[model samples]
Each structure stands twice: as C-alpha cells, then as structure tokens.
Target: RKDALFEPPVSTFQPTMRLANVSGINIIPGEDTFCMDCRILPCYTLDEVLSAVEQCCAQIEEEYGVEVCYEIPQKSESPATPKDSPVVKKLSSAIYRAHGIQARTIGIGGGTVGAELRREGIDCAVWSTLDECAHMPDEYCIIENIVKDAETLVEFFSE
Candidate 1:
C-alpha cells in the first residue's frame, strides 16, 4: 500500500521491449532484449542499488542460461530540500495562499530539472496538481489544473 508520505520511499523498474520481426503470433522471440528504467529512491546510492541489480541479473542469467545486458544512460541524485529554507518558506506561503491549504515538503525519486538546480546550490519548489501521469504512457495535462497552477505561480511570483 502507498501512503501520501511515500514513507520508506519507493523504487520502480519499467522494462520496454521492441520486436521488429515476429513471424508467428504464438511464437516467442528468439532473444529477449529490453531496457530497464529504474527510478531508485533517494535513500539508496546508485552503486549500492546497481550492484544489487547486477547480482539479480546474474542469477537470472544462470537460471535461464541466457545473457542479459543493461546500461544506465543517465542518472542523478539530489540532496533533500530543507523544509525551513528560505525558498521553501516562500513557496509554502504562496501555495497556502493560492490553494487555501497548508503546504508540505516531501521527497520523490522522479528526475526533474530541479535536480540540476539543487546541485548548483539553487533551491526550487517542483510541484504539480493532481494527474500524476508524468513520464508514463498516454500522459496528458488537465486544463483545469493548468489554470489553478497558474494562480499558484502568480502568487509565488508576486511575492
């Protein structure tokens, strides 16, 4: 079960395979090949999680007598944004004003431009309204949310 806090954090592994030529509908592919997109929780280091994945893949290779190859094309980890930081305080105030609710801070494993900014010693509040379909198939934006988010941004910028 998932809670709003994302307590203990969460990791995801999504594999995608593309088959070019399949002669028969019932026939399995001669070789399995896929890329894994792993969004590791911020609590774990890349080396630690990568080593674990390698060990698991080794076991899979031994069990199936097949080879497996995987590569990390890109990866980044960001330090947590301090809840009491000035930027956070400002954003929280803006959010509360625009939405008429308390603003809370939380961490997520998703990659964002904020990672780069944070690494450069800049603080930013990365947020969104509902949908939660980022980086997934059939992802779309809700117009209502866009308008509401604009209000939030206006509140932020006007501060």
Candidate 2:
C-alpha cells in the first residue's frame, strides 16, 4: 500500500487540509472535506487532472452515499524552454563565463511566473541560480552564489 502511494506516474498530490474529523480519538462526526496540493507534471494537462478528480469524486459519492464536492482554486501549466532559443544560449554562455562550465536547460515539476508569458507565445525562462530553499524555515543563499549569478546576468545582458 505504501508503494502504491508513490507508484503513480502522474503528478504528486499532498493533502494540505481536512475540514472535518480533525481528531480521530472519538466519533467527532461532521461533513468531511479535504484538499490536496497538486504539483502537475509536464506530461499531463490541467484538464486531465480536473477530469480525474471529478471522476474520483463521482465514484466516491456512488460507493459511500455521502455528498462530495470539489473545486480547483488555481491551475496552470509550465512548458519547457527550447534548448536552442536565444535566451537559453545567452544564459548558457553567461553561466559558462561565470563558472567555466556549460549550463543546460531542464524542466521542473514546479510552476513559474514565466508560464504566464509562455502562454502568450513570449519566450521567457524561469532560470535562476537559487539553492531552492523556498518556503522553508531555514531558507538561505550564499553570497558567492549571488555574486556569480549577478555576473552571469551582467554577461548575459551585456552581450
């Protein structure tokens, strides 16, 4: 059962809220509601996830005789940046100049603001040299990394 939890090929889902049955020590019964934070994968569309969730709720309602309802507060897609794009080439060159190594573009499971522009056919990248400590209590960045990243940006822009 634990393996089945992680075996799905789709995006990851984490239960973030439970509106009812907070404590299971007793039969503190009420309307049960739960929400999942879905991190979409690049391979699947938002419509696919929406359809799957709707189907799941329908099946639960049929099998359990309990009313169920759900809604997606927000949804988005982040397309991968093309490798040969001018932006990618410039950023890669700057990174090489700053670090003496080649930089490669890669897709991420997380969403980025660049996706908004990307939807409008604008070529934008969410590239950064961050250590990815976002939202953590002890999130931090090294000064050297910042300096190098600045240098890379300067090089990218100056060219």
Candidate 3:
C-alpha cells in the first residue's frame, strides 16, 4: 500500500555554504598525505580570482609536486573591484612575479561562517604568508612567514 501522506519528495534544495577542499595522493609509502580546506569569502572579481588560482597552482606544483583543483559552487558570480587594492592586486602580483606563481581572487556563492559574520555586520579579511599548512599529518609553518604574519597583525591592529 502506498502512503501518499508520509511520502515526502527528495529535496532538490542546495546548500548555502561554499568551500575549496584540497588533497594530494602520496606516491611514497609512510609519507604523510595532504589535504586542506579553504572556506572561501566573497571575491571582488574574476580576474583577481584567476590570478590567485594561477599563483596557487604554480606554488603547489613547485612545492608539493601536485596540482590543486578549484570547484565552484552553483549560482556564484565573479565580483568586480578595483584592480589596485593593495591586498588583492599588489600582493598577489608580487607573489606571482617573484616566485613564478599565480594569485587570483574568487567568490564563494554560498554562505559560510565568514559570510555569516558579515551578515551580522562584522567586517573581516583573510590572508596568508605561507601556503596554508594547517592540518596535514606533518604540517608545519615557515619561520619567515610567521615573522611576516606577526608584522602584518601589528600593522592591522595599529590602524
């Protein structure tokens, strides 16, 4: 017997948070494999994103012998912003040129913790001095980048 009243249709609804999950396969035994996730923030433009992605891909290939892939969530649009923003344009450009890498900006179409904060009227920005080495089995941070990160934090707090 079919129970029409209790038969709810499978949801076609999509989620509202966007993310970039990265992973690497190890060709060697006993070496710690790699994986990480970046909770994306809203981006200002496509070109900015492209630049950042190019930088990331180049960096990963050089440093880890791997290529990172980007997966975009549904219904996202490329944002537009000034090409001269110090963080977006200048820093990314410098990183790419000096290291033969690429840096581009991208948007997260769905909501995130960061996005939720913004919705509650909190302002925020994100950056990293080194490749985000947050959660791999043998994860590590670069000393130089730590110093630079400290300096940047000081500068931010000063303002």
Candidate 4:
C-alpha cells in the first residue's frame, strides 16, 4: 500500500513541452500521502479553461460513467482584481456558456505563496486547468494538460 501510494506507475504521459516548475507538499509522511502542487503561472485563458472543463466532464461521463458538476469561485471568495483580470473574466464567461452556471471571481482573504511572492517583488498569478484533484487517493495529472500548461507557461514567461 505504501509503495503503491508513493510510486505510481509511469504513465504513457507525453507532453509537448517541459514543465517550468513542479512542487509538492508531504502532509502525512508516514501515511505515504502527499499533495501535488505546481507553479504554472501565466498560461491560461478563459476560453481554454471552459473548453477543458467541458472536455473533462465528457470524459468523466464516458469513462467513469458519472455526472460531473463544476463550481466556480464566488465573487466574495476570489481576489479583488480577479474580475478585472482578463483570465478571470474569460473563465466566468466560459463557465456560464458551457454549463449554464453563473461563475464569478472575487478575493480570497488568505495567505499563500502568491502573496509572499508579491511581497518579494515577484509578479505571479494562479490558475488551474483541471478540476481540483491535488490530494486524492489516486491523484494523477492529465498528460495533455501538462503539455497545454507548459505551452501556457512559455507564453507567460515571454511577456
């Protein structure tokens, strides 16, 4: 069980680009459980996010035979500039169109590395293309997503 948790079989995961940075948090070391987090800032758009969500839902339905519901962050729960941010606005619009769900971005009143980076004079943004599946029993990354994210980061760093 411990080995299985720590060493997942290498997937046939072929990505179009290399990762910019990858990091993880080991919350329960003895339990052999960990959280996978990565910094792939600056590589997402609202349209792409929506399309991916739609595709994810379809895949889940077809493969797992389950209905997937998507939830967008509440306006009061997101960052203050989230709505003004192009990425956030696009995400809200795409979710509304694809899922008939009214999504909004707001401020999150919490501490994160993002805040620390800002304090240290590093500009950063946080976004995700996948459903929040960081710390599950069988956590895994979608290979196509890694490729898209790598491309996104390349573009992000170029600006």
Candidate 5:
C-alpha cells in the first residue's frame, strides 16, 4: 500500500498443474509438476519474489513428502512510466479524445509485454477495454471496444 495515496498494492500467486503423461491407468505416477504465476508488487524485486517462491516450495516438499521442482519460465521487471513522458501523454490524450474519459496512470499487478520493453529503457504503456470476462467460457471482446481502441490509436498516431 502507498502511504501517501492510501491505495493498496495488488499482487497475486496463481498455481496450476497439468497431468501431462501417464504410464498406465492403474500405475502410480513417478512425479508431477506444476506452475506458479507470481505477479509481485512493483516495490519488490524479482529475486526477492523468486527466493520467496523457492522457500515456499521447499516447505511444501517437506510437509507433503513430494519433490517440487520449480522454474521461472519468464521474469519481468515492473518499471513505472513517468506520467509526463511523451508516450503516456499521447496515450492519455488519445484516450480522452476517443472516449471522452480522462485516463489515469496506475500500476497493475499482472505483467504485460510492455514491461519487457520498459526494462530495456523504452517508454511503454499498456491499455485495454474489457468487461472482465477474460479466460472464461463466455470471454469475448466487444466490437465497440475494438472500434474505440482503434480510434484511440489513430488519435495517438495523428498527434
């Protein structure tokens, strides 16, 4: 949480496992693997989160008596884009022009491809319109959202 703004930080850990292969219907599997998606806070470093995950895995291995091998397929650093930066200015202005809504700069818990670009010293911003149906059976993108996003991009490019 930010003391000055009284805003809470968003972070999450999601665990997933898949039964990739099986020897036989009745045979017990030799091992199983799972994945952990850690969306850490901007204040924490990647190494810190990784270390915490490793510790958690170790504890689970000891408590459950099952071996746990973890790997980070990808790690991205969350860097803030200055509100006054040209890219942000253009995006904010475009959003207002396209939707007549004032866009506010904010931090997100999920990692975006822009994070990679930001880590490379490039200014990047991630934006989208949604109704919170992502990854669901009824997930979909509205046509109006597509049109609005396109208009916003056009406005950004124009100026």
Candidate 6:
C-alpha cells in the first residue's frame, strides 16, 4: 500500500499503555496496547490489510523483545459512493446552484453516519469543506459555511 499516502486514512493506529509496575515516573511501561481504526479500500481486501498489520506487530515484537497481541473488536465495511450516483449528482447540483461551481467527490475516513446507510444501499451524501482540524480537540468550521450549507441542503431537498 505504497499509495496509502495519496489516499485517506485507511488505517490509523493509536497506542496506549497500562502500567504493570508503577515503580517511578521515568520507568518504561511493561505493557502496551494499540487500537487500529482500519477502513477498507477497493484496492485491498480486509484480510490483506489485517495480515499486513499483524506482520508489522510481529516485527515490532521481534525487534523490541516485547510480546504483542491484537484483536479485531469490531468489523464493518461500507461501500463507497460512486461519483455518478444519483445522490451525489443531486448534492453536487445543489452546491453548484448555491455557489455556481461544481463539487467533486474525495476520499474521507472516520465514523460517518452515511457509512451505515451506504452499507444498506442508500446513496445519500454528506459533504463540507473545512480545515484539517476535523476530529481533533475543539474542531470547528466557519460559521458562514454553516449558513451556506443549510441553503444548499434546502436546495437539494426542494428539488
């Protein structure tokens, strides 16, 4: 997955630690854990992605002499919304009407409610343009964009 950099985050790892020995403030933790939010892309199967992750964990264990274990707490995959989907066309049209420009589809990752509906064969769209602060602490979007988004949605639903 050398091209992963060009894609949205198909996988994100966040490592955590549990102290087995609280000997001192400077002591190395004896146990560590990591959870991965792994999303699926058409380029690779879920099995292929997990296998690659397992291999990486194995390498870390060998290099650091630390035991490693992992589990898939949950498994869910949603089909991607095609650019030509009716829902996308309608939304794009709404955006065009609102701003006199086209709206293009791009890859985005994270837990979106649209993902659940898309899995159930719904093609509805949710979109916005914002800075990289999404999903971070105190994330925000422009107040003006909110008003514009409402206007766009009104156009979309009125169609």
Could you give the candidate ranking by TM-score, starting with the highest? 2, 1, 5, 6, 4, 3
Cα deviation of 105, candidate 5, in Å: 2.0
lDDT of 3 by residue, 1-159 (tens): 222211122112234444333344434333333333333323334456568768977998899886566554333332223335555555455555444457545433333354455556544334457765564587888898877666655554544
Pick out the ten consecutive residues of candidate 5 with the lowest summed lDDT: 1-10
Which digits, one per residue and each the tens of the lDDT, describe model 6 over residues 1-159?
433432553544444444355567898876755555555664566677789878998999899998888778777667677778999899999999988878867655556888799889897678775677976799989988888888898889989
Worst 10 residues of 3 by lDDT: 3-12
Structure candidate 2, residue pairs in collision = none
Candidates' RMSD to native:
3.5, 4.8, 19.4, 20.0, 3.7, 3.7
Compose the digit string of candidate 4's lDDT tens values, residues 17-133: 333333556343322222222211222334554686589779978997666665443211111233456655555555555445565343333345555665565444554456567
Model 1 lDDT tens row, 1-159: 233444435667777655465678898777755576676665567888889988998999999998888767787876667668888888888899999979878766667788888878887778678687877899999899998889889999999
Better of 4 and 5 by lDDT: 5
- In candidate 1, position 70 carries an lDDT of 76
- For each candidate in turn, the TM-score is 0.74, 0.78, 0.31, 0.31, 0.73, 0.72
In model 2, the Cα lDDT at residue 108 comes to 52
lDDT of each: 0.77, 0.73, 0.48, 0.45, 0.77, 0.73
lDDT of 5 at 68: 82
Name the candidate, 1 or 5, with the larger TM-score value. 1
Can you write out model 5's per-residue Cα lDDT over 1-159, one digit (the tens) per residue? 342211245566777656566777887778876676766666678888778778998999999998888667877776677768889888999999988989978766555788888888898887888888976897899999888788889988998
Candidate 2 lDDT, 30-93, residue by residue in tens: 6777788887765667888788888998999999998887777777886656768888788888
